[model samples]
Target chain A: MKDNKPEWYARMKRGPFEVTKFDSEMMRKVEERALIDRIKPRKKRFSPWAAAVATAIVLIGVYFLVPKSSLSYPDTQEVGAGKSEMTAEYVREHLKIGMAQEDVKNIFGNAAEGQSVKRDFAQPHQDDPNDMRTWTAVDIWRYDYGVGEGYSVHSDLEKDNGFDMPGIENGNIESQLVIVWKDNKVERAFYKYMSSKGLESTQIGPAIEDFPDTEPPISDEAKHDSEYPSLEVRAIGESTLGKFELRPRKGSAEKIQPLGAPSCLGLDTDLTITGDYELFFKATAGGESLIQNYEALEIIQKENKAIMMQKFDFPKVELYLFIPRYTDCHGLEFYAYGIDKKTGEASAFTFQEGDNAIPYWTTSPMVLPTQLDDQLVVEGGRFAGTDGATRYRFQPDLNKHQMMLEGKEQIP
Target chain B: MLTRDYLKYVSDIPTATLQELMEEHGQEVWNYAYFLTKNVDMSDDIAQDVFLRAFLHIASFRGQSTVRTWLFSITRNTAINYRKNAFFRKVTLLEWIHSASSASSAEEQYMSRTFTDTIWQLVLKLPPKYREVLVLDAKYELPLSEIASLLRVSSGTVKSRLHRARSKMKEFMKEVERREG
Candidate 1:
């Protein structure tokens, strides 16, 4: 209303501006979103062996990103002093690029996000120094993990059509682990951890006289917001996760592919799911014909066992509730596997996952097809060793994908 | 205040500035989205999304564009994307059918207020680029340079698009008038 708008535009001002009551919803979403952003890992929580490996390998006058011909052998670790049962020497001689994404996941865990990237590795043409030549059209999988994407303040930008502003002077900081994959193999790894500090004291960038008189805000907000806020726990696939809803579960079971079962057996082999398996045959909700994965409309339970089945006619969805049968060292991990009865394909209700700590999403909890009642859809669930149970409502079309979160706090 | 203040507020504490942002520009964004989407719910959703994204990316708010311009640009893209989504199309179709099938005379009259007039129809009929430029130019009264920045196009492109949009609108009105007479 202050800046001079067009006069005829006043006629177009379709007013009677009755604001809708979406404040609570917006607030809750904003709070959860902020919470999720905060939960991304700022510092690398590396296993001692991996950390030692990275440190040692990065030193050896290195071939960090090269598709290597050989490997480095680390010296050794004091016996009974580390969690990685594998000897540091074994790890050193073995690891290299041309490793499967799954193999990487076994070591580094599942990536937070994967993006296909094309980087032109350009060189000056040998014949013509002026001519630019691209050697390879490299297609890479850029996997980002726990990281803080620090921002730069572009002040006096009007002065520069060219981006000549001193970026380091603006005090920008970022921490990220980018694993690039080419031909389904790890091609390169880039790790950067930057922090904003006084040029006189810090060793990262240039000195104090380097910057202009116009300095950035003094608050350590960039540092603070860059890490987890509360819940002190990584989010469950709280948002986007795994080969999400893209490929249908039921296209003829081609081959038994173990999706990141973590080959605790060996580096090359995978931990396959073979022992306890359950397949169901059911009549459709309409009771017309047969369906493969649907339940026969009943709550099935067995004592002492954590897994159970509940047929909540809320959208006629069949969910197999179970906990991963891992050593009960940590808190029990629970998952609700949704069954596409038609395909008899059951998918773990996990959409995406971050480092073992961060929460992600499964699928949007849905209301029944016909009834449309006020029942909250179970977006995803989590069980922490410390915090007790709390129901997260499916906040659909709210965040990146539909996510379930526990609290509803109003953001300012 | 200016975009600098917004940048400061954002960098200070990202989540703490949503109240100020919503209070300042929520309605204009909603109205802009509403005109583009032609669906009340879709408009509301897009407006909420624009604010949500702005809140999330508050750290990246470089003060390159005015807050209003930035927000409107987001609203613009969000509206276009929502329109493009297959799920959105399906949902919109379902809503149209549901409302059409069930609406009474009074309900239809109330719904009529949603861009039912001839001029509004003509505006909506324009292609997305022209429609966007015209609305931002004539409705929001954004400067050509700002519009150029928002649309990621040159000022010349924005001008030509606006000119084309106005010419098309005039043509629609004249044709309608001739037919009516």
Candidate 2:
């Protein structure tokens, strides 16, 4: 106790429970609440939904009251200037694939220049290098909805907090509508809904509403050449588990050693395990189960439960895993999506417990693949409190390029 | 800080100033709430509410205590209120610490966990009163007078609570070591 008084107090004084990195969304929320309070009559509190409704009614009135001539796009017009119905449903219903720029503008007013991302999908002219007009280029525009609702990333706050995702700057983006214009005609169009909670169930399809009940109207392009490959993880039967070898190749498991101290390259990496819980992953692509031992600590699932686990810059692992942490009676529950970097598409693998799809949960001292095996075996299930080590394997859909845990079978 | 200049000003705090305040003391407020209510979701809500309340009612903040302590005071109150509310589900302290199992023995997990994690886990296991006082003294390193004022207790009571908390932690840790051996 005496020895602990000095050294222990020093470590405790360092504030281990203290959150080193504050969540920007929480900060924005706090500010938003305060702003609302300041604007309202003193000491009166209104529910956020009520305020939203009231504001909507007023905005709707203004939209209808505005002159028809003013509704027309004036080249420099913005989304809110005339078009208030630039919602996901509106875009899905009204917008078409091959609409001209002028026609699209007349419908949805204009993209808010400040809150949109524009890039010329082009290169230099082959013939006249100096002449900028000669080059053939497609204009791609990304108009993000709910930007003002603390949806978009403030780069300064992100940098100050040491969290950075270059291409995926919209890590916390709620909704986005992207339009690609080629030769003055809309070549491609898609509406994406990215849930900050990392719920793969929320994403139906391009032009689908958030948390839609009906199936997504999957475009012809989506059916054949999907931007993101699928990832499925399921509990394999006893027969598959018996024959499965995580590293089937000779000496392949030992070829790659576990990372020395669970290190990562991301600026705001939450790779700390709760204690000595070491979680390793069997990285499989195209049905070849490759082993990579990644010892991840409990990255305390905070306000924004869905966080970019790791920004894999490595050539082999070019996917971002967004795991939303949930703890049921079993222990810590999580479902992760392996997002493709190039296509900005995501592949998800989740485990089912009862009615819930809880991809993986660590029982007490959490670990994945408990041992090196050909199949991805997660150690924990409903009987975890007593039986312990209820192994579930990742059922790989090779054709779909997905690994999912559909059901769990007890291994004796 | 915004504590010194804006102490007497009875106006709604500017968003920038409020953000600056959050940046400075947000973690402590959050950690304090987490310590009080071992629920992450509740802590998030409590911390956000604490800052919002502070920003909205800057007029109530007198220049008596540091801004951090004031925020802590608000956080304690907010967390207490959350518990008292009918809708709030209290996650018991025991829930945070996983009971030793034959499959994944406590010894095995304890061996891998950092001493800091073990210590914190043990601290969380203590009774609410004891844990509160001990965390204030050890984690936050608040003066006895400040802690007593914040908890609305006398200095002697604070001292007694801290002593008991430390004793309990020492005993729990020793038991851990004995089991490991």
Candidate 3:
């Protein structure tokens, strides 16, 4: 908590460098260069082989290999000599633009070293509904190759900071492969490795064109139910939208497709609340009723409105959790429901609140749900007069059909 | 900041907007490049390239951060790319020796001509990460969150680096005082 700024910083603000100022002359040169680059024809897309050869020539003797066009390739060790197994060549050859997470795991012989999913929603234009924010969930997977054991200033600083620090490295740097997945498909991939002088990164394929953050065109079939003020539930159809209850004054609820869910659902789980006050959850996968006509009684009982739904997985189970946007209670809270994907049996996750075992909820500070081992933990605190955070763990029964609160720990 | 509403949802930046941006942040960007590379000539090229890249890739600007933060991120990336380029590194290695000598003479010249502070010289001598967070926080007065975003590290990391940077600067200043004494 050393929050005070040193007095020397005030003196440093004057800036000691006497460099080329961004004057009219420099601006004119930059403008000219930009104009020339815009008018110049882009270089032809380099084939995998050509790109490798070009890289090898440019970086002489500094570890480069030809990317194989086919997925069938030798093991990591067989691919290169005297360099990290996950070379830029090996990554570019194996990782395709649209490969799935499982496909990546298959190629790399294991899951990624680190992975995370983030939902990025752009601010929507109020005037145009078409300009509304679309769901763009970016799932990133990182694979590191090579191993180094030594104490160095660069690596030590990097370790002190989080693992997200890329590019900076000492001699014991790992050849890193990063894959950005969108909608369960590889959207972008890059490989990074250290040369003698510094770190070098290579984008695997053609530069990905940035898709404007606008609502995608709904299909003709999906367009039919695009109308509001109606409830459409399908138990055995290909895909269906869930219509939920909404408070009369809050206007028509916006249809928000939930965040990253398993691909096993095979359909976008759309939650639409309209004129009808019926709340139901419908999910169909492979022409099977993953969750059929499951009434959200707990959600309906609580007057709080559910804004979005998120699905997280266990060993062999997937649970869909609905998040209430606005809670009238002193603290933020949400309700979660779990349905065994294989057995189609449903369960509700509830925690003890005083005398009553109420549906799962947290207080002022909302801690999102995360799976630890075989348990689902939801944490919240500072509700009403509560001081510290409360941690609740939900341990599913042996059948995995029900989840009960195992215990609550008061976090300081 | 530019008085004119320079940023609009557009595929490319208008010449007027570009001029306004350069007028507003050009010197800061140039100085930042110098901080990274420690070479004035390379800083010149890098500053130009940053604006040029910004002009060409205006469509990619999502307005997640302010124009200044975006420009600084670009500057850092451009400097990193330059550092990685073997040809530029060789040229910079030679420039490093020349700049070192020129910097010492510049220090002497500034001492006689005007009041000179050796703190920035010590800042330039610090490692890249610490130097960047320190300069960005102290000079630009950017929020820790923005520095974290620009550096692609956590806010905690930025705070730690800042603390360590100031400590190192204090040590360097003490050393200078000892030598002078």
Candidate 4:
């Protein structure tokens, strides 16, 4: 009993319980509810039989809708030999998160110049090799589909979110289809779909449709289910209208605002337990917002920076809210909660003041991975600004708990 | 691979083939939830929620992870969230803790009775995080790295937590000895 190891751990306990019969009745109810809940006005127009019939008939019609470009290469060779041409609907439904770039181009047509990673750079990557950091080059492709017209990533946008362009100049990311490519395959894709068009205000959530991960669609599950013909989309591709500038202004350090809106990457709360109970938050606000989230014993801003870190250790373990003042959007948004490489001391990634009118900026939600170095180091993130986007890394000092960073890269 | 007839039924309700696939699976899930919560009602609720998630998100299952592993991950998340609720926290687990064993054989019943009474008593005393890692690691044999990914922490963090959890259990065992000494 007094020893460090307990006998009960080795006492050979009974394994998990075994149930002979499953509650099929309950599962049936849940399945029925899921199916019934899917009924809506947009989809209601097409009866199940009609949808299946229409889909079968529309293959030829949709193939003609493919956007063709001069720079395109013929990819019809790879179109599942003997399979019919894929419609944009088939493309959207079949495309998975980590899909091939060739498959994307295979389904959609050749990407236009402005819609791809090979856009004519002011400093063409080959022209200026000195300034560029080492990168595991990822080709980014953008697509835009419309109501009157159809899908085209290179379509001239009245207002771009500045999402795809190298620098943050002028644009809003409204209905932007982004696919990140690494080693010539899809690394991660972020497709936004407007959820509710009925309301004056719209909410964009992650598009759920994707090419089913690497597992080949061996099952005729797709073929068998005619009722669930289309991807379950409420309001698919309605582009957003209004926009906001991320440009910085003078006295920007003092006038802080929430990163985006509360719902959109502006604030996130997580529950963590180490030896203590903590509800950690990664947000872009300051002072009172810190107190509102957690009962704070101490709220300190590292080295007079606007970022505040609150520590709570009551019901055991911990919860911290790292709130930074990203008041003016354009200039600053990078923050980190990591330890210092030199002193073995931890650092808080707080916000900084910046100049306004810098158009090049990324709209990445401010988040610090729980395992900072591991996640980011493997899947590298971007440190962007109006000047141009660049590769960023969090090199942890082998000293175990600390890390190294470039200027303004480390949170305060 | 020849698609099994069960696989054929799997596409209809998303629940049909699962109902068959999970006949053996449900017991493991129910038992894991019971061990974690030490409460049958909550375990039942958590197990149901786990299966429901599996059913709804079946389309997202790319066979990246085995269905068993995925089910457990969902189970662990659901149980942790369930345990954290203020209502569940305030309620007593004492009643269910007493009702742990009902084996038929005399010697089997005696061993299980003592095992549930002593070992589980100490296990239940550990913190939620410790209880989770210990059950997953020592019980379920989940590797530390897998535990780390499941909990969304670093492998280093998971290693540290597992070490501390066992050490805490040792300390709890000592406290129990001191009480009945």
- Supply the TM-score for candidate 3: 0.38
- What DockQ was computed for model 1? 0.05
TM-score sort, best first:
3, 2, 1, 4
Task: Give fnat for candidates 1, 2 and onward, in order.
Answer: 0.06, 0.27, 0.31, 0.06
Question: What digit string (tens of lDDT, one per residue) describes model 4 on residues A151-234?
Answer: 123333222221332111122223334455556666444344332321011111122322123222222322333422221110
Note the Cα lDDT for every prediction shown: 0.41, 0.48, 0.55, 0.40
Best by DockQ: 3
Best by TM-score: 3
Selected candidate, larger DockQ, 2 vs 4: 2
TM-score of each: 0.36, 0.36, 0.38, 0.33
What's model 3's overall lDDT?
Answer: 0.55
Report the C-alpha lDDT of model 2 over A82-156, residue by residue, as the tens digit: 223344435644565555676666655566332122235364213221111232443555554444333334321
Which prediction has more favorable lDDT, 2 or 4?
2
Scanning candidate 2 chain A in windows of ten residues, the lowest lDDT window is: A234-243
Error of 2 at A238 (Å): 70
What stretches of model 2 exceed 4 Å from their correct place? A1-7, A17-21, A44-412, B1-5, B90-117
lDDT of 1 by residue, B25-126 (tens): 777787778667666667656777677667655555566667787677677767655554333555556565665556523433454454424456567657
Over 4 Å off, model 4: A1-7, A15-412, B1-16, B35-38, B80-117
Candidate 1 segments exceeding 4 Å error: A1-8, A14-24, A39-100, A103-412, B1-14, B35-42, B77-111, B114-119, B175-181
Pairs clashing in candidate 3? none
Question: Native contacts recovered by candidate 4, as a share?
Answer: 0.06
